[model samples]
Target chain A: MDDKLPGTLPGSRRPGRGPRQAQEIYRATLELLGGGGYDALTVEAVAARSGVNKTTIYRWWPDKDALLGAAIVQSSLLRFDVPDTGTLRGDLSGLVHRLVGLMTGEATSGVVVAALAAVAGRPSLAWLAREFVTDRLAGERAVFDRAVERGELSGSVDPALVLDLLAGAVWSRVMLRQAPVPDDFADEVVKVVLEGCAVRA
Target chain B: MDDKLPGTLPGSRRPGRGPRQAQEIYRATLELLGGGGYDALTVEAVAARSGVNKTTIYRWWPDKDALLGAAIVQSSLLRFDVPDTGTLRGDLSGLVHRLVGLMTGEATSGVVVAALAAVAGRPSLAWLAREFVTDRLAGERAVFDRAVERGELSGSVDPALVLDLLAGAVWSRVMLRQAPVPDDFADEVVKVVLEGCAVRA
Candidate 1:
């Protein structure tokens, strides 16, 4: 999804920075976002906080939304690294566990709630929310793809529905209900969804 | 949820009114909410718009949150009349169809989006959002209870998870993605979830 950002300046144009610089910039972005929200976030503020040149930030990210999008993609909030646990159930369980941690984590969850609040408050940033969810969905699709290849799931199963069910249950429990998720939540969701899809397949 | 409102006045203590008057009040509340959001909603405006006495409105609902909560429950946006289709699949499908309509309908969807925006913007009113979801979940639980009684589903199945998945997927599609749900979405979700739970049971 970061690849879809508007400006992808050439590597040569970058000021010969290391990954440490990029991490600093993203951290500053999230910190500013968490503190004052989207309206408070600006390329100039991020540059000042991270000591990165504003011109360099603009050279890579075209606008504030692009910068925030990139920062969110780099954040723990949107990381959807597919797990290859050899079985569909195991892979899903691993993914759900990571999601639970992200939602429950102190620093990460605050950033997430802030971002969502920003999007909810501003209609213009609705695209960012959509893009964020779409990107994560795309990343999570790999698990189902691998499951299909391994013959654990038939191609007939709807990956979107499966992923939505899994993540939705967690969102409902964590965000909506504002209740403690049981220790076995990830395993239970994975078990039911995998069994449901397997039977349908 | 409306019953859980802070103050519920007795029938004998109020002014005489018919269902039409209550409907007018709810309609006015929704209109104000849909127009200017939560900040614009007030007991005074609702009374003016509905032509009901402010004292009477206050007698029934103590404050703005209570009024808004009651209006929401009375609106089609939160109705969760469980279907008795004789089978869990049929009942769930019916419920999902109604949910999809509420999310997709031109008028109802706007009210839903407005109410959600209000809740998201104001942290204090988060209880309203939580109560709204909890109420709907409680109402929808009847389907599972009936299915259990008929032996179609084991009591082991998680009703909360099931409802979350169904509503969550629709929300993801209609609100998050701003995408049109496929015609068969309800049926597809019901089929997979029921088959999945059946296998687990």
Candidate 2:
């Protein structure tokens, strides 16, 4: 998520004023995002809620969008590290189950979806997409690229599209809220796409 | 995609209007969409561009958004059909490859991505995702469900999410313009995803 708020004041690197105040502001920001949708997330409210001056908040984030995005990225709620158990299937299966756990559990997939839908409206949010997408792709892409380098699969395949296509489907379902990313669905996604079951006639 | 446009006079079906007129209006709608993206795809301009009467255009589509949708779905451009080839790999591989083709060729991927981005601002278009999503899923779900019943795989898997995760990844890439869907990517998408490779481990 890109920071939706644009006009941010850069923060203080001074020793005494940093940790406690920044933590409070970030907490309030997350609380606001949780309680209200992304549109309702306000720097003014974060300042008030955290008892931090508005200047302090602005100093940390460039804009409301950026603040919100930073809050989300920093969030322990949806944070994850992709697992690597040697094979793509094993790794992705665990990842998918974890994903379902997040989407269905405390992370509040529906709210994130709505927030993202809301973000999708703003052109400025492209920055947010880039930030999160680049960061998130790191773990998934790492495993696939490693496998290719090991000659585990064909060198001709572009892992980028492979990752995007599978992940895209999951994101669409979550954001569109059309269906749940079911328990076994992710495994099926990894399986059919990788094995090339189609015996070319 | 559903014909958000009914192609009838406001109150009733006009028996008099023929396919040529319908084709012309649809053509105008696409041209307008091509020229100015979704925001400028207006009924009056479509009428003016195609030389069809404005009333005729409105008679079919209730609004520009509906007509814009109609233009996208009705265009013979990027048309695709499911090929059974009596195998899951063939079907899935073909689908992935075709989706990649459709997205990469449109160069309009950015337009569609931006359009999806833009739709976030309009509540009217947000609901329209289901309309477009359902049409795309209908054909694939039938094939998937049949495969399950045939003992090709476990019946417990949710066919919907399978499609969602698969389709979502492809679209996320296209909409984000992060990468192009390459030809060989389809093989990985088809293979690893279908055989329940992850679960087998």
Candidate 3:
């Protein structure tokens, strides 16, 4: 099951411990982050929660930020398969809908909220936020690339700007405004953006 | 300067204290929010910093969240004039550029970051974030209203979504990715969005 998961951090598994143990550590870290937030998260608390030895955990990750960063990267909450729906509109619509679910889902939203809180509050963890966004953007770039290849979008259309506008609207609604996302909102956004980016004859 | 500022919370001025005293308290609150974040902020700290009695603050606010909410509403950092450039493109371009500056500005970014941290981490303060966004959106609605009046945009266009996308793109770059905002980025976004919302001839 773990092997099927996308983008497991390389070398996360140590000499003696199996991938199962690493998963346990990551799980504990996320729970703590969701429950108490970044300031209250500590290596010792993770060790206690995971039942992993403190010394062993410390040997693997240098500090709380490193540990939290690893957990965030490896966590299922952050992972999503890039959509391939044969058109930019279809792909973006599907992606944005899923993003709304991921960000607002009860099972995952706490961790999302906690991670964002850490990103905003902790300067040391800013790199982690950047890496997470960059990695996600890179993965989503495939959709735009395919659209350009299909002539649905201009080659000159900036994928980063397109994706940012798409995702930022969702983030603003979910994270900043904490408002209910109206049905059809995602489709409306995708339509406008695609129209905005359509290659003029 | 105080009188010139927009949206000072009503009834904030007490019998003995002037608007000057209220400004001092708000200033001190923002400073503490910037310096130590929401978790470390306290009524005691504000009183000490602003030279206002904790009793007076408590009499007005009733709690930390209330005090913080008032401070955020009254802070000059959150205030901006609604641009009226006669066209949707010009107005949105100016608004997005100002947003990028406001979110990334050295004098204001810390308070912005701290307020976001509070919003994300503290559920009780979520209302504060919602209120702030709603108020800002209400203020900017005039831009879209003018565009519709001039037939520069469709009457059917959703102002909330447009504003969210524009501001969200900036926030995603400044607050999430912490990436540098390119010189032409704002205008590009505005152009795309306006095209997307253009009135169908």
Output the number of the DockQ-best candidate: 3
Off by over 4 Å in 2: A1-52, A63-69, A80-94, A97-111, A114-127, A137-166, A180-201, B1-51, B81-91, B118-127, B138-162, B180-183, B195-201
Model 2 chain B: weakest 10-residue lDDT segment is B5-14
Local accuracy of candidate 3 as per-residue lDDT tens digits, A1-201: 243543333434434433457788988999999998886799999999999999888877778877787788776666778889887788999899988988898878898899988898777677887767767877898988888787777777888888779889999988888888999989988877867522232
Clashing pairs in 1: A196-B196
Model 3: DockQ against the native? 0.47
User: How many pairs collide in each candidate, listed in order?
Assistant: 1, 47, 0
Q: What local lDDT does model 3 show for residue A96?
A: 93
lDDT per residue as tens, model 3, B145-184: 7877776677787888887788888988888888889999
lDDT of 1: 0.71
Clashing pairs in 3: none
Error of 2 at B201 (Å): 6.7
TM-scores, all candidates, are: 0.80, 0.63, 0.88
lDDT of each: 0.71, 0.60, 0.79
| Model 1 chain B: worst 10 consecutive residues (lDDT sum) | B6-15
Candidates' DockQ values? Answer: 0.36, 0.25, 0.47
Error of 2 at A201 (Å): 14
| lDDT string, candidate 1, A87-187, tens digits | 77888899888878877788777676667666654566666666777677777788888877877777788777777677767766776556678999888
The count of backbone overlaps in candidate 1 is: 1
RMSD of each: 5.2, 7.2, 4.2
Q: Give one digit per residue, the lDDT tens place, for model 2 in A1-201.
A: 553432222232222233455556666776677566566778899888989888877776757776676655555555677888887667766666666665556546544554455455454565665666666666567776666665565555556656665666666665553455556676666665555332223
